[model samples]
Target: MGKRHSELLILKEIAELLNTGTNMDEMLSGVLKKLLQVTELDTGWIFLMDGDGSFQLAARENLPPALCYQNLEPMCKGECWCTDRYNNGRLEKATNIIECKRIEEAIEYNWGETNGLTHHATVPLRAGEEKFGILNVGSPKKTFFHEDELALLESIAFQIGTALKRIKLIQKEKELALTAERNRLARDLHDSVNQILFSLSLTARGGREMTENEEVKETFAFLQDLAQEALNEMRALIWQLRPQGLENGVVSALCSYGQMLGLNLQTEVKGLLTLPGRVEETVWRIGQEALANCKKHSQQSDAMIQFMIESNFLNMLIKDSGCGFIYDQNQELPSLGLKSMKERTESINGDFTLISHPGLGTSIKVRIPI
Candidate 1:
C-alpha cells in the first residue's frame, strides 16, 4: 500500500479502537499498541496530566530494558524534555524530540541497555484547545521522523484526546444523575417517615397527659422519649444521604453533619477547596463514613478532621481519642468500617492509612492526587 493510504488506514482503525472502551487507561494502552504495530515502531507510551500539570504514566508498550529498569522507575518520575516543553507550553505539534533524555541518562549511568534507541517523535494530546498530555513513539536506530510520520502521529493523538474527553463527560453525566436520584430519595423519606415519627411523638405526649394511673403515665413518657430519639436518628441518616451545606464546601458540610451526630468537630483546612467534582464527592463520602464510625466506636463527643492540599494532592485526616480496638491483619475492621473506607479511597487511586492502638486514639488518613 502507498504510504499515504496506509497512514489513513491506521487512523481509521485507531478511531474505531478508541470507541471500543470507555476506560481511559485501557483505551490508551490499546491505541498505543495499535499505533506501534501499524507504524512498525519499536516503542511507545502515553502520559496523562491533570489541570494542575501533574502527570501520570498512563500507558506504555515495548519499553527498552533501560527505561523499564526497577519497575519503570525512569518513566514514573522526574521531568524530561517532552514533559517540560508540554508543561511550559513550548510543545505544540508533532515534532522530533531532541535526544531522549531519560534513556540518555540511563545509558550514561549504566542503568541498562537502550537497544540503540535515543530519540522519539512527541505530539501533544488535545481536545479542541484543551491540551491534556502527550504521546511519544520511537524505534531503534531511527533518529529522524519524516513529515508524513509526524503527521500520522498527530492525527492519532487527536483521536485519543477526543476519546478521553468523551469518556470524562460521560462520567460527569453519570455522577449528576446519581445526585438527582439521591435528592429524590431524600425528599421521599422526609415526607413519609419523618412525618410519621413526628405524629408518633405528639400522640405519645397526649397519651402521657390523659392517663390518670401513675404507672401508665410513666410508660407513655418513656414511649415519647423513644420516639423522639428515633426521630433524631432518622434526621441524621437523612442528612447523610443528602448532606446539608456541601455547596459551602466539604469541611463545612462535615461540621454540619457532626452537629447532627451530636459530635463536636474540630476541623482545620489548609489551601483552597478547589477540587474536581468526582474527587470532592469521594472525599465527602469517605469523611462521612469515618465520622459515623468515630461516633459509634469512640464513645467520645469530640473528634478532629484536618484537610490540606499540597503539590497537587489532597490530604484528609480524621482522628478521635477513643478506646481503639485491637487491629487484626487476618480480619477487617467491620465495626469501624475500615474495609469500606479503604475501598472508597482506592477506587480513586488514592492512598489509605490507618493508625490506632488500644489506649491511643485512632487516625484515618487518605491522600489523593488532584
Candidate 2:
C-alpha cells in the first residue's frame, strides 16, 4: 500500500477503539494492541499522566524482557529523556527516535534481555496545551523512523488526546447532574417532611399542656420527644446530601455533622488542609457514614476523627469507644454502609482499613494518596 493509504488504514482501524466509552484502561490497551498490530511495531506503551505529573503505565504491548524485569519496574517509575522533554514543554510533536533510558538501565544492571530493541519514536499527547502524556512505538533493531511514520504517530496521538478530554468532560457533566439532583431532594425533604415533623412536635406539646390526666400528659410528652428526634435526624440527612458546610472545609463540615448526630466529637488534624477536591469529597463522604454508623451501632456518645498527612497520603482515622461487633470476612455487609465507604476509597485509588472486635470500639482508617 502507498504510505498515505497505509497511514489512513491504521487510523481507521484504531479510531473506534479511541472513541469507546468503556473503561479507560480497556480502551487504552485495545488501542495499543491495534497500533502495534497495524504498524508492525515490535513494542509500544502509553503513559497516562495525572495533573500533578505522576503517571500510570496505562497500557503496553509486546514489551521486551529487559523493561519487564522486576514486574515492569523500570518503565513504571523514574524520569527519562522523553518524559523530561514532555514535562519541560519541548515535546510538542512527534520526534525522531530517542535513546531508551529504561532499557539502558536494565542492560547496565544486567536485569534481563533487551531482545534487540533500542529506541522508539515519541509523540506528545496533548489537547491544545493540556498535556496527557506520550505515545511510544518501537521495533527490534529498528533504530530510525521515517518522517511519514512520525507524522502518522502524531495524528494518532491527537486522536487519543481529544478522546481523553471528551471523556473527562462527560464525567464532569455527570457529577454536576448528580449534585443538582441531591440538592433538589434535600430541598424537597426539608420543605415537606421536615415541616410535617415540626408541626407534629408543636401539636404534641399543645396536647400535653391542655390535658389534665397525668398519663395522657406523659404520653403527649413522649410523642413530642419522638417528633423532635425525628426532626433532628431529618436535618442531619439533609445536610449530608447537600453538604453545605463543606465550603469551609471537610473538617469543619464533619464537626458540624457529628454534633447534629448527637455524638460528642473530638477531632485532631495534624496537616495542612491542602487536598485535591476529589480526595476531600471522599473524606467527607466516608466521615459522614462512619459517624452515622457510630451513632446507630456503637450506642456511645463519643466519636473521634483524626486527620493526618504523611508521605503524600491523607490518613484518616474514625474511632469510637462504644461497643463494637464482630466482623465476618466472608460478607461485606452493605447494610452497615461499610461497602459504600470501601468503594468510595478505592475509587480514588486509596486504601481502607476496618478494625473491630466484640466489646472493642471500631476504627476505620482511610489512606488516600494525593
Candidate 3:
C-alpha cells in the first residue's frame, strides 16, 4: 500500500477503536492491534505512565497470560522518543537504532525474541500538553519504519492518547463522588443513630436495676438485653462505616462484611487491585444486598463470600445454602432493596448474577473491572 493510503487506513481503525466505548484495557488492546496493522511491525507494546511517571506495560500480544508485563517496567520514566520528539517540536521518525535507542531496547527485551523488532518507531502520546505515555512499534527488518511512517504513527497516537486521558479523567471523577458518598454515610451513622443507641443502652441498664416485682424485673432484663444488642449493632455499623482496618484493601472490606453477617463465612479477597468509584459503589451495594438476602433467607446456618482479583477485573462470590427460590420465573418481584442493588450495579456497567436451583442453594457472583 502507498504510504498515504496506509496512514488513512490506520487513522480509520484508530477512530473505530476509540469509539468502541469498551473498558480501558480493551480499548488499549484495540489500539495496539490497529497500530500493528498500520506499520506491519513484527513486535510492539504500549507502556502507560502512571501518576508516578513509572511505565507499566499496558498491553502486549504474544506473551503468556501468566507472564505479567508488570516486571517489564519502563527503563526511562518520562523521557522516550515520543516525549523527546514532542518536546523538540518535531514529529519526525527515529528510523535507525541511534534515533530510536529506547524503542530498540524495549523490543529486544519485551518481544524481540519472538517477534524480532530490529527496527521501530516511537510516538509521543499527548493530550492537551499532558504526557500520558508512548507508543512504540518495532519490526524484524532493519530500517523498516521511515520518517513519514513515524509521523503517521504520531497522529494515531495522539488520537488514542487523548481518548485514554479523557476516559481516565471520567473514571477519577466517578471515584471522587463515591468517596464523598461513603463519607456522608459514615458521618450520618456516627452523629445520629450511634449517639441515640448509646443513650438508650444506659437508660435501659438503669431501668433494669430499679425494677422490683419478679415479672417486672424479668421484663426489665429483656429490655436491657435488647438495648445492649442495639448498642453492639450500632458499634458494628460504625466500624463498617469508618472502615479504618478495612482501608488497607478490598480483602479487609470483605472480611469485615462477613463478620458482620454474623455467619461463619470463609471469605477470601486476593489481588493487587484498586477499583474505580462507580465499580466500588456497585460492589458495596452488592455486598449489602447479599447480606440482606442472607438475613432474610439463609436460615441454612452459614454462608461464604469470596473475593478474588485477577488481571483488571474483580470476582465476587456469595454462596449460601439458604432456602433457594425459583428465580427463573421473574421470581419474587425483587423487593425495593434488591431492586436498588441491581440498579446500582447496572448504573456503573457491571454484571450481577444470581444462581440458585430450588433444592441446590443460592450463589450470587458479581464481576466488575477494577
Candidate 4:
C-alpha cells in the first residue's frame, strides 16, 4: 500500500478498536498497541490527568528495561520537560517533539537499552478545549518525528480524547440517575414509612396511658419504647438515602445523623475537611454502617468519630464503648453489614480495618488518598 493509504488504514483500525466497547482501560490498551504497530515505535506510554490534577500512566507498550525492570514509578509527578512546557502554556500545538528526561536519566545510570533514543514526541489528547492527557511515543533510532508522522499521531490522540469525553459524559449521566433514584426512595420512606412509625409510637404511648392492668401497661410501655427506637432508625435511614446536609460538609452531616439516632457522638476534625464528592459519599456511608453497628451491637449510648487529613491521605476512626464480638478468623465470618462497609471502602481504593473483641468495644478505621 502507498504511505498515505497505509496511515489511513491504521487510523481506521484504531477507530474501530476504540469503538469496540465502553471499557476505557481495554480501549486505551488496544489503542496504544495499535499506535505502536502503525508508527513502528519501540515504546509508547499514555499519561492521563486524574481528578486530583496528577498524571497517571494509563497505558503502555513495549516499556524499556529501565522502567519495566527498575523501580520507576508508574505515575509521573512534579515537573518534567514536556509536562512543564504544557503547564506553562508553551505546548499549543497538538504534536511537539521534546527531550525525554527519563531516557537521559537511564543513559546516565547505564540502566537499559538507550541506544540512539534521545527525544520523544508528545501529542496533546484533547476534545475541543478540554485537554485529557499526553500521548508519548519514542523509538530506539528515531530522534525526531516528521511532520506527516506527527499529524497522524495527533489524529489518533484526538480520537482517544473524544472517546474519553464520551465515557465521562456517560459516567456523569449514570451518577445523576442514581442520585435521582436515591432521592425518590428517601421521599417514599419519609412520606410513608416514617409517618407510619411516628403514628405507631403515639398510639403505643396513648395505649399505655389508658391501660388499667399493671402488666398491660408495662407491655404497652415496652411497645412504645420499641416504636420510638424504630422511628429513630427510620429517620437515620432516610437521611442516609438522601443526605441534604452533605451539601454543607461530611462532619456536619454526620453530627445531624448522630442526634437523630439519640447517640452521644463526639467528633474531632483535624486538617482540611474538604474532599471530593465521591470520597465524601463513601465516607458517609461507611460512617452510617459503623454507627448502626454500634447502636445494634455495642450497647453503648455514646460513640466517637475522628477525622484526620494528612499530607497525602484522609483518615477516619469510629469507636464505641459498647459490647464487642469476637473476631475469629476460622470460627466466624464477617457480617453482611461489615462486608458491605469493607466493599464500599475498597470501591474507592481506600483501606478499611475493623477491630473488635468480646467485652471490648469496636473500632472502625479507614484511610483514603485525597
CA RMSD of each candidate after superposition: 2.2, 2.6, 10.8, 3.1
Model 1 regions more than 4 Å off:
2-9, 328-331, 334-336
TM-score-superior candidate, 1 or 4:
1
Lowest lDDT block of 10, candidate 1: 328-337
Write the residue-wise lDDT of candidate 3 on 1-370 in tens digits. 6886986877687898786644877888877887777666655667776443446566765432122234543432336655455456574433333345554455556633433334456666777677776677765545555677767777777887788887878778887777778778978987898788778777767777887777887777787788778877776566555554445555566556666657666766676567654566467657756775776686775787788877556888888887787777356535676667666666755677777777677888777755
Give the range of the ten consecutive residues with the poorest summed lDDT in model 3: 61-70
Task: Kindly list the per-residue Cα lDDT of model 4 for residues 255-365, writing each as its tens digit.
Answer: 877777778999999998989878988999989888878878888879999999996689999999888888864543379888898899899888988888888889999
Order the candidates by lDDT, highest first — what do you get?
A: 1, 2, 4, 3
Single out the weakest 10-residue window by summed lDDT for candidate 4: 69-78
Greater-lDDT candidate between 1 and 3:
1
Model 3: residue 91 alpha-carbon error in angstroms: 11
Identify the runs in model 3 with alpha carbons over 4 angstroms from their true place: 1-125, 128-174, 177-181, 218-222, 225-241, 268-281, 308-313, 329-333, 357-360
User: Model 4 off-target regions past 4 Å?
Assistant: 2-6, 16-20, 51-53, 70-79, 95-98, 107-118, 213-223, 323-333, 357-360
RMSD of 1: 2.2
Distance from true position, residue 258, model 4, in Å? 1.6
Per-candidate TM-score against the hidden true structure:
0.93, 0.90, 0.52, 0.86
lDDT of 2 by residue, 186-222 (tens): 9999999999999999999999999999999999999
1-370 per-residue lDDT for model 1 (tens digits): 6886886787678889787679888889889988997789999999997666678899999899999989999998888999999988998999998799999889988989898899999999998998879999999999999999899889889888888888888988998898899888889989999989999999999999998999999998999999998999888778877999899888889999888888988999899877887788889889999998888888788899999999778999999999886775456655546788888899999998888888677899999988
Pairs in clash, predicted candidate 4: none
